[model samples]
Target chain A: MIDIKNKIKEYLTKKDTKFNSIFEINKMSGGSSNEIWIIKYLDNNTENKIVFRRHYSRISEKENLYPPLSLSIESEVMAVAYKQKIPVPKIIYNVDKDHELGESFFMEFIDGITLGNKIVENRSVKLLKPNLASQCGEILGKIHSIPYQNIKDLNTSTGIDEMRKYKNIYQDYSLNIPVFNLSFKWLEKNIPPVTNKCLVHGDYRNGNIVVSSSIGIKSILDWELLHLGDRHEDLAWICVNSWRFGKIKLPVGGFGLRNDFYNAYEQSSKKKLNKESLKFWEILGTLKWGIMCLKMYDAYKSGYDRSVDRAAIGRRSSETEIDLLRLIDNEDRYE
Target chain B: MNNPPSKEELITSVIEFIENDIIDELVGQKRFHAHVAKNSLQIILRQLKLEEKNNRFEKNRLKEILKMDKDLNELNKILCQKIDYEEIDINNNDLIDHLFKTTMEKLSIDQPNYSAYLDEKTN
Candidate 1:
């Protein structure tokens, strides 16, 4: 178990939280890019629970895991987003080397299904589907409203910079994929001029959202990719088909219409959205996901995280290729 | 080696074991990984059964489009290079059709149930 419990004790003492002992430590698994565990401890005869996430030792620094961000930065971003009233898991503490734990942190555990299919298909959650689009827009408006100068150490970028960064990663792999190259050609030519740069929740999608039957979007998790970028990146990523969970017709996270989502954003943020830029970002988001799939495949082939799931995910790059083709060619569903 | 238990026979038996026995026995997160493994094996089985036919079809299409003869992998590499350098116009009807057909064939092996694939296939 890597004696994670002992490390937790040290962390509690360092933060002056006054830990009694660990009640239980249960490992959690989802679309996790880190080692996540639910640690229940008793403090002054009272029970408490927190989610502890840390970098796994097996993870290589050399790995082309998406643009790397330190866990401290991730924690800070979470704090900033929470302060801005953006629905997020409240970060409790950032574990540093002084605590003798690897890069890790303590966070409030929000109970809800972040699984896309569960949110789409489950009868309990499906009742809240109609309200989800506007809720997403409202949360995104607040997240983007966080003044850019407040969050420290954020990489500022436009849509073109993102495209080039991802393209460079593709080239570094020395991987020549014709379809992806075609996407690069198209996105390079269509880079929109940036009218606004704000705090972008780089991975705001259906699967990243936490939902309950009564309270929709309890939290938006996974802030490791937080950056300053085109507002449309967050706007278009939710509409990506993979996040829609087989509801191809329902564009906004498989919950509502694009117009409804856009209207909700305008109502909340008072910013007019660019339809052309939105389309460009949708294409770019699809391309980025496709390339990430290829990277996972490479990780498996190179014997790095040799999980069977990674191998299956590698095959899934084709899904993004199809999405790109549909978007780029203006091919409507079933046509 | 000529064997009585063919590749398909071995694959079928293993798949049957996973589907009938293992799936029923497994639960929780392990069950999800089990499903993924089974699906991957099934994809391998399909590739084994279809590679000969698909490769021949793919190579023939490339030959027609590129106006030269080459192996399937080599032809694909060249096509990628052509697309990379803009040597071949991307809007060419043959190129689009070929790319679409290629991606669909891959999804048939990789994820046949993908919604986009189902929609494109039926159309």
Candidate 2:
């Protein structure tokens, strides 16, 4: 790779003169929007483990055009959410422009499985399945309860804005996805009323968090799309078909019942949830994720990144399309 | 174009080789990469075996529903444009049926193991 260890060591030495050596730096796989390296360094005969997250510069122009937020913004959001009793990685250090590794930050590495399939797979993390769904709802409640006024200036998005944005992304790919159009039409005709505004974790799915088989959700990761929007969006997103990891019958993250999830949210936030709005955002989240798959395809087709992961993800758009058909035909709601 | 080893046979052989040879020796990241390679080969096989039949089925359905003959891509583009302009008869059974069947057909190759695909197939 780029020998990032030397740069990290140099930067650490400046922050503290004792950090004179790097013990080991392992590049964690499954990197997408950012380059994540789990690093071990020695400072004053003491060893420390930290996750080094830095922006990947070689992303295609289309993917970069959206989401103008910086890593510092993510750090700030994490800090805010942590204060509100949300389980999140501790912000070790927020990198400034003076550091040579470009825009990056450090967080205390939390140990847990993050793979969606393993999170609820029978042979894997099946122990976590019993309590994860309700625990997920409670976590989202804590996040959504964070006051809108506190984080509104963070360049976030609202429901209508997100709808328009999803449309741009869908059309931007230049692929003929008729199912997307059908969903878009339905969303256009059925825009739910903006009852209130709150902090919405734009990507609150199974793979986006760290979960232990015993403790449930340890850290809610991936706040790159953290925004001020419908609180229901966060609740609905975890229920998307792909997020369920094949336990399609269980609507809430493929483990627990939806009724239990709703009860947990109502208990934690102490607020009555608007079910209709939740359904609206659920549809929106499905459409957005579907478009995200196509975005990966576009990235690969245009000679940006040629990872097999991207190519495989490109084929998953049909999964979203099938999910959309299920949703639009009203079978999803009954299930 | 039919050679000694047919396209399907070659694809299957390559996939089996990757699964038995390279994948077993790999660990961690290399193992994951090998898994991806295996899936990719399987996807290619699926596309080769099913794409023609799927395309013909879709084209026939589109022709019957829209009452016109056009290239497959062109027909799909037309359907999307019609939806964009709100000209689609959303409640029509024929249109929804076409969408459902086409999606399931694609998933039969794309992700036959996907839960929804199995659920639909069961029904």
Candidate 3:
């Protein structure tokens, strides 16, 4: 096993001129397949912290429902977003050529609450909750408005293409989920026409953001899902019931109403929000989450990640099933 | 025959042990994982208590909607294929009602406290 701690220390010393030595290296819980470490180092006799996120090969690509964007793509998107004055972490280092460290990047860690339950519960930042919807809208507006030529490397996948991708992954599991079949059938029949594709922050929910009481969203983390897609994909994903964290009444990431979010997004992006597209993407997003849960279960079943957490997450597909039924139900249960 | 402590009782004992004894003793990641373990066991207990009744209702619903008889797994698999092939209309009232009720029963076992499930239950 490579001594990752020593490699990180050596890399920091080589990259940062003022770097002295490491103080502490703690691992933070990251995505299911990624490893994130908090590196506290002594730079010019000052203690500083940075996050080192590395995508590990613990789970292979075949196990995942959606393959994550490459770490280089993630770093590039973060750099571009930062340049555009979007609320995102600053990329300190992009390690592409390094063969040993593998696919990873070092970023300046922004401190705030990134927990979905805490954000939705409105415990610490009661004032920040109401304004979060608009802040997200504004951020997403800026993200979607990013010029196509700037992020030319991002492969654009349309809504139908995305639906087909998830459906293919679902079939790969070969598990018969009636609700999932209904959702796929409904999405196939009601798939929205391909709109103008832009930089879509594929996962832009409350959990992926760092929020403070003072500054609403300090930085947007987790750009692994970044892709070129319809702007409504970003907008509707936040409204998915799974991200609401039990605060389903408040649809916009369980923070504020959709009207505020749409108005703010409209003001920022100068694009009218389409209700039909948003609704379609919302259902699609829910089904995607459900399939993702099944993927987690597959990981456990396949013995790639045999943790209790993953096993329990398999049961969570039912949550998305109820949410999907609610969304597709013509009685307007989504209201 | 198995003795005084039934399967549900055994699970309840473990959950109480975790809640009252083990969880507080541990900190940080260990405690968090202990909670997850307890929750997983609770889910199993809920499934044990509810699966038979839920399956019976689900099978009855499937029989009514599909107008045919089969075992639960076979019927569910058939329902999925029928939905896939567009044999049953997505907007059919009986189908929708069946899906809704089945999902609710599932949530009762999987996550009883889920917000949408609770909302639907109260409604």
lDDT per residue (tens digit) for residues B15-83 in model 2: 889988888898887788788878988888988989999999999998898778999999999888888
The DockQ for candidate 3, computed on C-alphas, is: 0.92
DockQ scores for all predicted structures:
0.78, 0.81, 0.92
Q: Compared with the true structure, what per-residue lDDT tens digits does model 3 show for residues A123-153?
A: 5565764488888888889998876585556
CAPRI grade, predicted model 1: medium
> Which residues of candidate 1, in runs, are more than 4 Å off?
A13-18, A30-33, A42-48, A331-335
lDDT of 1 at A36: 81
User: Which candidate, 1 or 3, has the higher lDDT?
Assistant: 3
For model 2, the local distance difference test gives 0.80
Task: Report lDDT (CA) for all predictions.
Answer: 0.81, 0.80, 0.86
Candidate 2, DockQ score (0 to 1): 0.81
Model 3 residue A12 distance off true place after TM-score fit, in angstroms: 0.7
Model 1, C-alpha of B78: deviation from truth (Å): 1.7
Of candidates 3 and 2, the better by lDDT: 3
Categorize the docking of model 3. high
Against the true structure, whose DockQ is highest? 3
Better of 2 and 3 by TM-score: 3
lDDT score for candidate 3 against the true structure = 0.86
The parts of candidate 3 lying over 4 Å away from their true place are A43-46, A331-335
Give a tens-digit lDDT track for model 2, residues A1-335: 55578888777778776556667888775345677888787756778778888887466556653644578877888888888889999898888966667788988888888888777774434455547777877888898887656543576577788899889877866779788888888888878877567777778887898877776789999887777777788888988888888888888777667887888888888878887777778888888888888887777777776777777888888888888888878745434
Assess the local accuracy of residue A4 in candidate 1 as a C-alpha lDDT between 0 and 100: 72
**Greater-DockQ candidate between 1 and 2:** 2
Tens digit of per-residue lDDT, candidate 1, span A141-201: 8888876685578888788788987888788777656788888888877878678788888
